[model samples]
Target: MTVYPTRLTQLSLLALVVVSMVLSLTSAPTMAGQTYSYTLPQQAYSQSRARDYQVYVPDNLTTPAAMVMALHGCKQSNADVLADWGLTAAADQYGFVLVAPFISSYDGLRNENCWGFWFDHHRHQGRGEVEDLHQIGLAVEDAFAIDPERRYITGLSSGGAMAVVAATAHNEYWAAAAAASGLPYGEDAASVSLTGQCPGSASFHSVSQVASDMAAELDDDYPIPLMVLQNANDCTVLQTAANNIRDGHLQVFGSDGSSQGNSEASSTACSPYYQDRHQCQHTRYTENGQAGQRSLVETIFLDGPLATPNLQDTDHGHYWIGGEHGNNGKWSVRVGPSYPDIVWDFFDRHPKNGSTSGFPVITLIGNNPMTVNLGEPFTDPGATAEDSEDGQLSVTADCSDVDTTTVGDYFCTYSATDSADNNTTRERTVTVVDPNTPIETCEQATASPDTHIATGRAYAGGTSNLRAYASGDNIDIGGSFDTWSQVTLHEGVPGSWYSSEPAACGDDSNPGDTVCTDWQDTNLNHSLAGRAYYAGGYFSYGGDDYLGAVAGLSSWVRETAPGHYQSGQCP
Candidate 1:
């Protein structure tokens, strides 16, 4: 028997159908290569579920690729984070899968949810957030054909802080991690903000405190290598905070259980403590002598049983990633071939022990031949060593051809060893030539200021006196001759010339004259007697003092001969 429905029941059924339709219309669709957010089950506090992130899979995905998780800062969206960090270009070039997660709010503050690196002090904050992030990374790895062992994490600013937390907390999972402009857990304001009131609390761990905790949790002997980038001039986060974090980690990892002392002076504009610790190799990239150049400082603590290495730098700011920063404050999309090149290099040296696979094959430029002339020094052109496992390998030259005596074509072989110990050898021939060339000598000659002039030219028809001056190169002629004499032109003429005789007179014998043979003046020749000459004057012998006074008046001038100087000439 068919029964007619009551009016109230029919209306209820119609309302249920309308409600189902509305729910279906409002629900978001699961699209390809898109991230979706879900609300987590309600706990003590209203917390959100982990976000599900996906990216478009290339048509060719035969080989297993690496995966990287990029986390966003508080109040930042996935799109903005992607735009700022921009790792897609690197992903495309290196065939690595990339994922980025967004945080929407904190304590119901609209658009205020940041990574919990700083706010973890609250019971329901940092741990849950970190777990969610871990789940998301595993989900992405499972969804894509990614190599779990090759998983990596890196971030900037707060995101950078998160990366540090993840690396320290989950060191077993990440092969390598890099943090820029961010400190370990206990180093940031989060630590102070959470534990400021409880100053006496002994069990409390600051953000930086977490690094020591995490290091303790990991195999202390070989903890994962961490790369930190910081800026010395960063106005936002003082460089001291970063150094403190570095020092704290060093203290935790060092054998002495104490941090190195500050070695830099205040006048140098660097923290003395930083210089001292860096010398111990406890930090990386701490000394930035050049502008924009990255400093890498490292220290090894806990030998053998448990060793943890620490690296630090002071040339990066919040949002400043490793490498060069763009003018617009965005990481460049173009990853130079060298970018992936270096990443692989760091990775090869640090291997995931779980896998026995060899490092990637690398072909390097080999060394070339060089030539040097005899007596000429020559430096090797240098050979390049490459390994198929590691990219652009480093080469050490045996320099067999480098000898003190060998002059013929010599062969020097260069050997390159990869991180895996795979080695390759290359030989280069260098031709040493012997040439004959004369070694020239350079000498300079000097002249003294000395002159002997005949008075016959001036005293032609009558007795006249002649005065002469002399000069030469490097000559010193301040004093006159020892003896002086003059001979009369006519023979047997007593007193024919009157007055004092010339102080610098010729010898009494008249050595160079035939006329008036041996005729001589009794006094020394005073060549310049105060502008007076003994012409037709009587000869008279005078004391040495009289001759010296007349000789003092006669001045000598110096002159340089043309083309008499040389420069840069060996004597």
Candidate 2:
């Protein structure tokens, strides 16, 4: 169901938090000694579940600029996110626009108004919560400049789950995504309660299953670079469920399990936001075949308690952790002191690699309706893909089943992917046909009755192959000289001769129709009967009598001339 905000949009006077790129890269997020507020319009865009949101611009770069959206966890407000998280801090340091959005109240939720993560929910693409958030993005674009290449989104807890969905479903919009303490593909987020006491319940799945399912959901051609922020000491969210954020992305990127690419423990002198020494770990993964070539996904693990005591009025529950506390008061801070600086450094490195757009587009090139002659060689025109960012893409066509050697409709398909992770596809079809066969000339003379045939070709001038007029399929209705099944030599006849199903011969009209009965029932004709045997061959309009049942077949009595009767018996 589409989520509709309970209240209509209301216009308000502008209050924008402005930041400067001139600020030190290693410093924490700050207002940089200036604040400007712009009045948001009554509405940004229409959505069933639309709601109010706030935006902070670091600097108004008239050219396209980057935009980062953050979603809060349960019982958390847009205001709370802006105050506690380092996204705003980074927005100031990097001169990017920061967006804060709200979610609806979840049913049976442990925290009030938490983001919803039901198993049945449609969490991909422009549906559900992502749709609601996208409208807010459109509003931000309309209000300020947004670099199409640098758009990014991240979230915490339940919001973290939402972030992954938004990125996976609509990868074209986000160049990269960072999910802090959330499950990818929404696994294990749904529960009877918010607490982590019963994580092993059947309602949740194993790390491998979660990783596999989430990986299967992603499009290989459009994998958005991801950073999974996890805490080593998080007690509220189990380490297994949380780690899939990184594992799932690696699986999607075709990684075989993984190994740590970077790690730092007990590093001091890291930030202005923290007085305590910082501890951090960075794990990186690359695509399977391209290992040591390009890193596709990474995870940052920090164990921390907020170094800046009383940064917020409340306690540090499930918050970023630093050096371990004696009471273990809160989970380790996966995103430690000066989180924005470290996070931004990673984001800055992975921009859109292919086209400026999301995925590649493909086009099939060939005759709209193609044709191939019987026994002729055919080559498919195939397809090609073009990406604005990645340029021309690699295409592969599958034509293993195409049989131009025989007459039939054959389908050939092509697929392609660009470096930027976009994909496109196209297909073409070729119809095989034989213009004529040797069966239409019914010029056989009436042979002497009861004459034993010596040679097989004596009956029809040695040209026994005839296309069945009733079914249009080639059938061996004559003697050893006939080989219609091999080359469709009987196409001269109007109607198809044989059945597509070889079993149709079992239903052949008994007696005279028993000769040459092993015809394919392509036309589904079950009434092929009445033809007599020539040269002792048992042909079928549809008969199963195989071992040369020539007794009732020699009686072909169709009279061609007024005075002479054509005989089924060969003399």
Candidate 1 lDDT, 250-333, residue by residue in tens: 444433433434321111111111101121112332222221112121221110101111001111222332111111112211
- Model 2 lDDT per residue over 280-322, tens place: 4555555542322234676666665423222121232355432
Score every model by TM-score: 0.42, 0.48
State how far residue 251 of model 2 sits from its true place (Å): 1.2
Worst 10 residues of 2 by lDDT: 449-458
- TM-score of predicted model 2? 0.48
- State residue 6's C-alpha deviation in candidate 1, in Å: 46
Compute the lDDT for candidate 1: 0.38
lDDT of each: 0.38, 0.49
